[model samples]
Target: MVFFKYPEQIRRVMYTTNTIEAIHRQFHKLTKTKVRFSKQNNLLKLLYVGIKNASTKWTMPFPNWNLAVSQLAICFEELLDATLDL
Candidate 1:
């Protein structure tokens, strides 16, 4: 039997996803006043800038991603193994 002993790691991964999502929501809140960006290019420019600024935050690896991905792959192995599971 495969044993996944790292509950904290799983929690950390979940927490990070939540935290990043919260930050994204904050960005939306902060930009809610940009209602005048009616043109597609103008909105795209704001999105581009937001993404560029957020990209600067990747200073380190998400600690459990390597193991978490492996565990997840194993959990969904049958789905992955099937040729047309999607």
Candidate 2:
């Protein structure tokens, strides 16, 4: 857990791969029934719809986001500010 070096608030934000894994699982579920798509757009559209449906449940905000951002700003002061125009 390389993220362990960060504070608890930041660790919670960084530690989980669940969201990405869930998205992959959704894509798998969407695509597994078909061996081939006749057109590239069809596959892309399916994945896009799957992502849209999965993202509908993402209404909740992360906890302690401001604190985590402050911590990140301290740790990556020059990089974060320069990247985000903060």
TM-score of each: 0.54, 0.75
Q: Residue by residue across 3-86, what tens digits does model 1's lDDT show?
A: 344455555666576756855775796589876766878777777777777767655677757776665556566765564342
| Candidate 1 clashes between residue pairs 3 or more apart in a chain or in different chains | none
Angstrom error of the Cα, residue 30, model 1: value is: 5.1
Q: Which stretches of candidate 2 lie over 4 Å from their true place?
A: 17-19, 83-86
| Per-model CA lDDT versus the true structure | 0.66, 0.86
Write down the RMSD of candidate 2 (Cα, Å).
2.3
Task: Specify the highest-TM-score model's number.
Answer: 2
Ten contiguous residues minimizing lDDT sum, candidate 1:
1-10
RMSD of candidates 1 onward, in order: 6.3, 2.3
